[model samples]
Every structure is written in structure tokens, then in C-alpha cells.
Target: MSNIVLKRWKRTEGVVNESYTHSDGHHDQSTQLSEVTLTGHLGREAQSPIEMTKSAGEAASNGGDDSHLPNTLTEDNRNEGEAGGGVSPCCNWSWMVVLGATLLMCCILSAFRCMGMAEVVEVTVAWGEVDPTFVLLRCRQLLTNIISSCFGIIFSPFLLQLHTSSTTITIIYSVLQFMWNSSGLFVGPLVEEFNWRKVAMVSSFLSSCSFILSAFATSPWQLLLSFSILGGFCYGLMTSLSYLIIPHYFTRWRGVANACVVAGIGIGQMIGPILVEFLQKEYGYVGGTLLMGAVLFHACIGASLLRPIQNQTITNTSVQLVEPESRTSGVVTAEKKWTTVAIRIFLCVCRNIVTNFSVLKSRRAVIIAIGGLLTFNSWLNFIALIPFAVQAAGHPLQAASTCVIVSAVCNLVTCLAVSMLSDWSKFSMKGACMTSTAVIAASTFAFSVVTDIWWQKIIMGMWGCGVGSYMGIYGLTIAYYMGVHSLDATLGVTQLLIGLGFITIGPIIGVIRDASDSYTFSIWVLAGLAACSFILWIFMPNTTQHSHTTPLSPIT
Candidate 1:
């Protein structure tokens, strides 16, 4: 008789279903045990679902259960059972339908958000009518993104599951966005007239009735309450939720999945501003909120599609769920080439971090931390300070904006190139970290010493490249250094340090700028800090030293 045992693990640990192979075909003649009977990843002991809480820290590369498989998984499937009927060309096309609807839902959500972006610009803040302070419209966007990003990342892991994660996350995103629409347009002003409690009540009411009300108030504090209370709750929940779902279904196509979602942001930003303008112009800002509310109410229609993953159980082993005829095949299908590539890229990145640091075993934790601190600080400062620096250096606002746009585009392109380069060169993530540090320092020096507009533009472009590349590299290094499974925690810890870096940098740079008659000295000081940061990164060791350079094992 075959034996089975279960194990407790964070879902990211993909090996819950380890298969043991015999040296000889010892069981070839035994009564054939159906592979479908041994469906789950068994461990030494069965673990209750409740015990599967997430592991703490930047522990290791992680993976979790993939519910369906068409071919040999692990080069073996453990038993002799007939493959399921789903793979037969004549099989019904239902799975494709499920997948099709899901992709459509995702696309709609992306497009609506894009329209809303353009709409936000049209909101005429009665700056002249009220307290008369105008927070630059674009500044709020950056802040919203920051706040949403932090919140989304932290909440994302919690949303993962065999089913329902995507839908739950979508509802949360829609609801929060609806609330944001109301406040940014109207409730924000109304609250300026009342107490904080009243503001809170009004904001909550608008969120509850967003399908009906759509509105904000007057004072900045009113805006803060709406955003912090309603916005904070929603933003934190959705950001992480958005990225993880595609990985669940399509590990091989992580890049494509990520691209699809990111494309949503680009689309949303474009449309949102336009929507805001239309609403504000057609019926006053108040009417705009109401119009937006009308738009938001329709989203709940899509929410119904976010259901539990189909309760699928195949009595046969090795089912290949194929849907060539269905509309959803592309969105729902799996292609192994990219997944294999992903695994290799992962290996390549891990090898780099380990070989460069030379502390894989004894100093695993330390190296990951060092990677987090300097890398995040050096790169994250792009939006935080670089633009400010350019403004201080006497450049036009458009020039600063152009540099940011170009750099972001470059980073997107390098997301693939750098991953491949690291694999090809076999340079430790350590090298990448150090190179970024050097770039930051060099760029900082150039910014400080150069005065001519042309030179400054060149310097900005150089600094922007560092800024862009570092952002993507930092995420990749953190994943490989700590483990993809602990990516959320790695990101969190990195942010903690980054937050500190921002606090220290803002004032130091500001004070230096103010104290000196010109920004020259301040730029040099920033460069010096970059140099100090790079030196600190030198001691960071590779976590892979602790294990063979595969994805780091999940912390037990």
C-alpha cells in the first residue's frame, strides 16, 4: 500500500507535493495505483489548513499549489491513471469560458481606471473659494500611488488562495476607487465646513452610497480623512492583490501577467483624469461626483464574476485542460517555455547574489537586509527627491517630467534585459547593487558640479537611468536574495528602511539647499551619501551561501 502524509507550509513552498522515484521499476507490476488518488503534495504529516500561516522574514524563493497540470510535473506523476477528459479535443469548452470572463473583467477595470485619471485633472478645487491652498494636482497622484502601493503590497499575500483571491481583490479595488472619486470631487469640500467627525461621516456615507452620491469636501484635512480612512483601507488591500493572481495561474508567463496588470495602471491614469474633467465641466464638481458615482455603480455588475475557483475534481490522473476553441484560451492558457525561462532566470539571479556576497550560509539574513537598505534608498529617491533637485537647479518643470518619463520607459525595457544580463554575466546581484550605487554617486556628483543646462540634462538622464534600473533590480534582488515566497516581507522590510532614508534625505537635502546660496554643494553632499551607501552595501553577503543556489528553500 502507498503511504501519504501532509505538511504545514506557507503556500509559497511548492514542494508540498514531492514525488519519490524508485531506482528500479519495483512497482511496475503492482496493482496500478491511480495518480489521481494521490492528488495533493504530501509531507511527513498532514497539516490543518489553519496552520499554514505565512512564514516570517526574507526567507527563501517560494512556490505554491498549481491546481491543474497537462503534462509531466516533476518529470513524474506518481501513479498509473488515465488522463482526464478535459484534454480531449472533443471535450466541452467550459474552462475557457471561465478564463475568458476573468480576462475581460481585468481589462474593463484597467480601462475605467485610465479614464478616471484624465478626469481627476478637471476637478476645479475651489482654492479661490475656500482655505485657498492648492496641492498641485499631480502631487496628489504621486502620493496616492505611494500610499496605495504600500497598502496594496502589505495586503496582497493575505488575499492569495486556491480560489476567490482575484474577485475579492477586485471588489476591494472598485469600492475604494469609488470612494476616492467622491471625495476628490466633492465630499472633500463639504467636510471643510464641518468637524472631523462630520467629515468622516460624510465620506463614509459617500463610499457606502458611491453608486448614488459620488462626492468630497473643502479642507485638506477633509481630503486626508477620506483618503486615509477610506482610501488607505482600499489602497493597501488591492495593490498586492493585483500582482499575485496571474502568478497563481501562469507562473511561466509572469512577465506577461505583470505587464497586463501594469498596463491597467497606464490606462487608468489616462482615463481617470479625463473622466474627472467631463464630470466637473458638465454638472459642476458636485455633479461630476454624482456622474462618477453612476459610473462606479456599474462596477458591481462585474464583481459577480469574481467567484470561487471552480470546484474541479477529476477522477482521472494527468488531465490536460485544453480550450483552443474558447474565447478565453489565450488569457487562461499555459505555455511552459516562459516558466522554464522564469526558473532559469531565477537560478541566474540567485547565483549572482550568492557568488558575489560569499555569505550564503552564515550571513544570509544580513546580506538580504543590506541589499534592501541601499538599493531601495538609492533608487526610490527618484520620485522623492530627484525632481525636486532638478527644480532647484533651475530647470523647467517639463524638463524634469521628461527625464522621469524617459527613465520609467527605460526601466520597463530593462526589466527583461537586466534579468537576462544577470543570468548571462553571472554577476552577483551584489554587483548590480554596487553598480547602481556607483551610478547614483557619479550622477549625484554631476548634478552638484555641472551648471550648464545641457550638462544638467545629461546628468539628469544619467541619474534617471540609475533611478529606473535600480527600482526593478531592487525588487528582483530582494526576491532572489530572500526568496520569492517572502517577497512581501522583503518588500515591507525594505520599505521600512526606505522610509527612514526618505525622512533623513528630505531634510538634509533641503537644509543644505537653503543654507547654501546655491544647490551645488547640496548635490555634492547627496553624492557623498550615495558613496557611503554603496560602501555599506559591500558587506552584504549572498543568502544562497546557506543552500545550493536554486531558489532559497522556504523557511520551515
Candidate 2:
């Protein structure tokens, strides 16, 4: 009888295990039997053994380790686990690190805007024997914008101290800017391939060296070599890396993240002039430049904090896996001559360009790019001319600097507020952008006609708001329509296109300043451009309904 009872029990256990496996796909017979035995202990729980078995199977399938399986088998714990595994919030520590570092970079770059060519031109005229002509000054400004916008500021106070002609300085500056901004194209691929921290380290070293070397330069060519070429290249590397890093740490609040990073420029603008002014007074330009080098070295710390996200997309994984194959194949064909290698590289670049052009096929993308080009051109033109306009109005250097300070402060506040609003509110990005463009146009026109310092301050604040609004919204707008994955390539293409405006507008403004002996005509022209940008935005599709609540997918 005892043997008969043991056989019956064994048969019953086999039936329960088979039923559990059939009901749930989890084939872990041991785990299911343990759960069934535990449920049987609670006499009432025996009635729901199947339900318990299903929950256990789910917990196991979800990749819960043996230790966590029992606790997370509950519905609430499973839901919590899912929420925790999703994209991290913006306020997390990792994101904070990215934000802090980006802000510092912005502050550093902002110094360039404050170190305006207008001030440099005045110093050249006052201290040097030969005054640089309007054309020469214009060329210098253009070159500065092109090569290293930051170095233009860093070296301007000292450029007049060199024994080179203004024309020579202009040429060197342009070469440097060209090297710096264009370097972004080359660095973008490396950044995508290797670790960004390595890029940041190299950039910091180059930038620091550029500043320290600039302090000892005595000729135009030397300045170009030290500050323009080397410094410009490094700056481009850092700039591209910064943009790429922010996207990795954010998705839901990307607009806010970008705004925070951009707001650092305002911080730098407000403080840079004061810092440089004080340093120049006590240490001279050479000593001040050396000090600037020390400050730039800290950027490496920020770069070091960047950790790669573990949840990489399948496309990224596949590319990484194929990289070794490509490298191995290249080694196998190492007998190829240099010319063949060069041709292959050129063809590869052409292919990439062709791939990137796919974005232009979309009407919405084209509209955004065009509007971005116009808005970017208008804002940069206004910034480049602000000090000149103020000085033209017969204001003191201090007053002009104060105008920059006020605008910078306003820009900082507006950038943060606008980004937050876009993330939280129901307002349409298109309408907001159009309204901001109109404000920019009107404020620029007002700046041209108004001479009173008080009114000029008001207009500068207004201009700052408009600029902040457009910049704050533009990135989010692109992400909304095209998706976040397209942002880097799209931005890169847009930058290249707008560079044409940068090269052409400065010369035109220079010609106008030379002909009219004032910035009135140039300011009006910029205002008109801003108005045109506003009109372009009007035709842009309304994206209010698809705001922050929607999940973004690649635009393929």
C-alpha cells in the first residue's frame, strides 16, 4: 500500500510539471516544481498553483536572476523593473556631468564673441603706426569667424602687439578658421568610431598648447601656426564631441539639455570680458593668454566623465562587428599603392555625402534647413556687429561691453525658459519660432536707428530673447520631424551650407561700413534677412500635436 501511494504521488508531480511547461514557454522544470511546492504549503495557494507558475515563468523570461526572481514575480515589482530599465531621467548624475562640462565649454567659447574685432581694430589704430583699412579689418573678422572663433578673441588683444600687417593677420586668421570648422567634418567620423574621451583629451591638449604658444609669438605666421591652425582644429573637435555627447545622455528632455549647454555661452560672454579686461590690465595680453591655457586644460576632466551607454542600437552593434572585417581585408590588400588608397578614401567620402543627401529629399527637412540657415546667418551677423554698432554710436568701450553683458544674461535666462516651455507646454514650435524671428528683425532694426544707450540696452535684451528662442527651439524641431538619429548629420550639413553665408555676409557688411561710414545699412540688411527667415518658418508644418509625449523613431 505504501509503494502504491508513492507511485501515485510521483505520477501527480509529473502531471503538474508537464502542465506548467505547456502553459508557459519557460522550460525550467526545477524552477516550476519549486514554485508549485511552495504554493502547496499555503493550503489556499494550492488552488492558484497555475497562476503562481505563470508569474514565475514570466519573471525568469524577463531575465530576472535567480535571486530576484521570487521578489519580482509580483506585478508591481515587474512594472517597477520595466520603468527602471527605460531611458534615464534628465536629472540623473550622468546627465549632470555632461551638462556641467558642456556648460564650461560654452563659457570658454563665449569669450570669443566678447573679444570682438571691433575692439581689436581700435587697439590696432591706437597702438600701431599704421591703421588697418576697413577692408583689412573686415577680412580679419571674417577669418576669425572661419578658423577659430575662440582664438580670434584670445589673440585679438595681442595681435596688434605683433609686428605683422593687418592684411597678413587677416590671411592667417582665415586659414585657421577654415581649418577649425572644416575639421569638424573629419573628426565626426573618428568620434563615431572611437571613444569620445580620447578625442576630448587630444583636443584639450592642443587647445592648451595653442594658448601657451600664442603667448610667445612675435610674428603673424607664428600666431597663425600656434593659435589659428592648432587651436582651431582642437576647438572643432571639442565642439563636435559636445553635440554628440548630449544626445546620448538625453531623449525626452533633449531640448532642455541643449539649452543648458548653450546657456554656458552666455555665462562665458558675461564673464569673459570682465576676466580678460582685468587680466590684460595687470598681466598684459601674453600673460593673460597663458592663464587662459590653464583654464582650457580642465575640459579634459569633463571628457573623462563621459561613459558610453550600454544599450546600443543594433545598427551600431553591426557596424562595430564589421569594422574588424574591413580592417583585416585592408591588411590583406596592403600591397596597394598610396594613390589607390587615396582614391578609395575619396570614394568613401563621396559615398557618405551621397547618403547624407537623403535627408534633403524630404520637403520638411529642406524647409527646416533653409530656415535654420537664414536664422543662423541673421543671428551671427547681429552678434558680430553689435559692438561695432554701439561704438559707431559714439559709446565708450565699457558701454559696449556692458551691452554684451546684458544681452548675455538675457540670453541665458531666455534659453532655459524657452526650452523648458517647449518640453512642458502645448505651444507650437513653429509659431514660437516665427514670433521670435519677428522680434529679432524688429530689434535689429531698432538697434540701427536708436542711439540712446538706454534704448540700445533694451534692444539688445530683445535681440537676446529672439536669439535664445530660435536656438532653443530649432534642435527640438529637427528632432521632432526627422528624429534624433538624423540630428548630427543634418546639423553638420546645415553648418556647411550656412558657412557660405558667414563668408559672404562679413564682406558685404564691411563694404557697407566702408561706403556708408556706419552700420545702419548693414543692420537693415540683417533685419531683412531675419524677416525672410520668419516667413520661411510660417510655411513650416505645425508640430504641436507631436510634442514631447511621442516616441521618436529614425526617419528612414
Candidate 3:
């Protein structure tokens, strides 16, 4: 028979209590970091509105029984270590797994663009027909990607608070993979069907596969369609999920953990294309395809490792409602933590805008807007402009593709350095934003003047580095600002503008390069934007100083 008792708890006031079971007749003896078992809902203990604050955090961990209430095991009620073992091993893996998966997600995200926008430029130069209308194709692909991302994120809020197993995430991932597998056959049919979600899923899967087999497709259409479907849609959603997966499992170091999450996409961006390019040349497109699909399979299987503690949805059931400070007169505690968080986050951003009218009145919104603006440059230029950047520097097709490899590596290194340092030094997270903006501005300015191949590598890689760092901190910023509860919606609100930034500027990037006979002006325009980021950074408050005073144990 299973019994429930509070084994241990980290009361927010700052103390930890442990209850270890003394073996009687040889039952297992053990200690839990915090109450992983949720007997009821979260609100049961709220004595005041201030009780509305987030529960004391737990160990930064994942893998528990979602089938039951989270706090089933209490400190006073220690589980016997058990003969066959009751706890699952999946949740015990370090945060590094999430980081590795995220990096691949980033690479898959850019894979499609790398193929059509980046690779085609190379393909055409090497062998044959180039679309004079490449600019038009570039715009279409980018717009589709942005729109898909916007909608994909729209559904994310619901999923963010829900406890899904790696199994659930993997199933979704597999459906996405099917999309890619079908892309070669269903390209025209997909356009006709008009079911964007299915098409989007299929596309996302294919894009992930592309990273596994980067050099498989031989034609312009193959590269374009694969990227548009797989890289744009498939990779995009999976990357988004990387954010959701974290809060469900780990609460401590949420921001730092998120940095690694963001870093995943960065690493993927770094690795995806290089592997594809190498495999494609070494084996043929078929061999390249198989290799990439296999890598994606590995990632998909890894996603399966995540499981819901208690094995039940936290929401459908009830939580014990405490009289939270945010509550009115008499309120019962028994709501999902998410229900309250959603309300708190939306209000926070809106209130900050109202109370800090100075932040609102000035270009702070624009500075915030700049973050969205920068997101557009990564895949957009990689697809349309970087190839040109490569050609302009006088490299051959294969060698020019190496430029992306360089850009990827630099992005990974810089983001890791920035994130790890920020977490260790406890620097303000904004320090990262400032650092990225500074590097981007300096690099873009230098890129505008440099024409030598080696110089191009340095400058372009620097630009990519800035983008990667920003991506690394993307969710962490929201986590820091609105707290983890507002993460999805804040991302939603921020990304709408970000999507616009991509939509608005992608064409101009192409047009400027087309009209000027030189990329000098375009690089400068981006450089100026990067500088504006720095100016905005000046007005932003420092986050490193935020107090980390909560009791360091799992919420009982």
C-alpha cells in the first residue's frame, strides 16, 4: 500500500527539512529533495493573496509520475528505496540533453533555408540554371516560415503548462518527421490540401531530416520546398517546444537552464548544415538523406525520455486553494498553478508598460521591437544574402557553404561562453543582450568594409554569433521578466512583432543588395539596428541583481 506524507519542503522563508524513513522489516529508506508528489492542487494552502506567489521551487529536475498529484511522496513519508524500483531513470539526466536537442533543433530550423536560400546559390554557381526571380522565392519562403511560426506559438500556451512525457513530444515530432518523409512525394499535393498544420508538421519533419542528410536534394525546387516545409515549419515548432519542456521538469536555475535550451538551437544551427554538406559530398543525396533522418530519429527518441511526474494532467484535477494575496475575500485553494500564472504574467507586462510610462513613452518598445527585428536576419540572410556574401568574397560553391559552417561554430561558441558566464557570475541577463548588440554592431560595421575571404569569415561569423546569443537568451528573458508562467504568451506577444520584423526586412535585404551592386549598405543597415539595441540596452533594468532568496528545495 502507498502512503502520502510531507517528506520534506523548502518553505520560501529559507530552511530545508528532511524526513528519512527508518527501515522496519526492511522496507526501503530514502530522502527526497522536495515533495514530488502533488496530492491535490496548488492553491490548497494559500492563506493570503500574497500566497499567490509561485510555490517554493524544487530541484532542477524532470521525470516523475504525472499520473498522480505531484506531492504524493512527502518528507515524513519516505518511500522505501523499493525492491524493483519505483522512480523512473529518465528524469535523472542532466540539463545537457535538452541543450543537445535544442542545438539540433536550431540547425534543422535553418536547414531548409540553408538548402534553398544558401545552398541553391551555391548549386547554381556550380552546375546550372539559377532563378533570376530568386528574390521573389526568398520572400515567399521567409513569409511562410514566419507565419507558420506565429501560429505554431499560438497553440503553445496551452501546451506549456501541460505535463507531457517525452513520449508525447516525440509523437508530435514523429508526425513532423512523416511530413518531411512525404515532402518529396507530396510537395504539390501539400500546397493543394490547404491544411497548414499537417503540411507544417510534415515540413518541420523534413527540415529536421535535411539536417541529417544535408546534401541529398540536387535541385533548386528540392532545396526550397524541403526547407520551406521542414526547416521553416517542422524545426520551428520543435524549437518552440524546447522552451515548454523545461518549466515542467526544472524550476531552479530556470533562467540558466533556459539559456542552455536556447543554446540548443544555437548548437543545431552550428552543426546541421556542416553534417549535411559533408555527408552529401561523401555519400550521394540518398546517403546524405539517410544520415540526416537518422540524426533526427535520435533527437526524436531523446524527446521520448521526458515523462510526466504522477502520470496525470495537473489541470484536469483540483489543487488545494490557499488564500493567495491576489485573491478577493474568501477563496478556496484547488486550481492548477498555470491558471494563476497566466493571469499574473499578462498583467505584469501590461502593468510595467503602464506604471513605467517612461519606459513606454520612449523607444523602449522599439528597443524591445529590435529584439524581434534581429531574429529575421539569421535564416533570411543565410538563405538570400550569405550565399552572395560568400560569392562576393570569391569562394567556390563548396567552399562558400563552409561559410555557414563557420557562422554556426562561432554562434555556438559565443552563446555558450555568454550564457555559462552569465549564469556563473550571476550577471544581469540583459548583459547578454548588450553583449550581442555590441558584437553585431561592430561586426556588421566591419563586414561593410571587408572584402577579403578570411575577413568575411570573421565578420560573418561574428554576426551569426550575436544572433545565436540572442536566441540562447530568448526564453530566459521572458522567464526573468514575467516569471516562467508568462513564458509562452510573452513569447507570443514579442514574436508577433518579431515575425513582422522578418516579414518587413527580408525583401529589403534582397532589394538593397540587388539595387546597389554591393552588400555594403545592407550590412550597415543591420549594423545600425544593432547599435540601436545597445542604446535600448542602456534604458533597460539590470536582471543580475534580482534577488534569489527562495528556499532551495522542492515545494511541499
TM-score of each: 0.51, 0.69, 0.54
Tens-digit lDDT string for candidate 3 (155-265): 112223343333343233233333332222222122111222233344445555654433444433343444434454455445454554454334344445656665555
When sorted by TM-score, best at the front, the candidate numbers are 2, 3, 1
Per residue, candidate 2 scores C-alpha lDDT tens digits across 73-158 of: 11221123222231232123446546545754653464444445455566556555433233333323221111225434455556
* Every candidate's lDDT: 0.37, 0.56, 0.43
For lDDT, candidate 1 versus 3, the one ahead is 3
Worst 10 residues of 2 by lDDT: 1-10
lDDT (C-alpha) at residue 154 in model 2: 52
After superposition on all CA atoms, how large is the RMSD of candidate 3? 15.8
Give me the runs in candidate 2 sitting further than 4 Å from their true place.
Answer: 1-97, 103-107, 110-154, 184-187, 277-287, 309-354, 391-398, 543-556
Instruction: Please write out the lDDT profile of model 1 over residues 1-556, one tens digit for every residue.
Output: 2221122122222222222222342432111111211112111122211111122212232221111101111101112112222111111322332343334323333223332111112222211221101111112223111222211211222222112233333334333333432222221111111211232333233333532321444432343354334543332223323332232222122333344444444444445545645555677645655565555434333223322222222333454575667736554433444465456545643443333222222243454554445544444433434445566677765665565555445544444345334433244566776777788789768766665667766766666556444543444455444433334343444444444554454445556556875556655766776677678667765324212111101111
Clashes of each: 56, 3, 76
Model 3 ranges with Cα > 4 A deviation: 1-118, 121-234, 251-299, 311-369, 378-384, 393-403, 543-552
Q: By TM-score, is 1 or 2 better?
A: 2
RMSD of each: 16.8, 15.5, 15.8
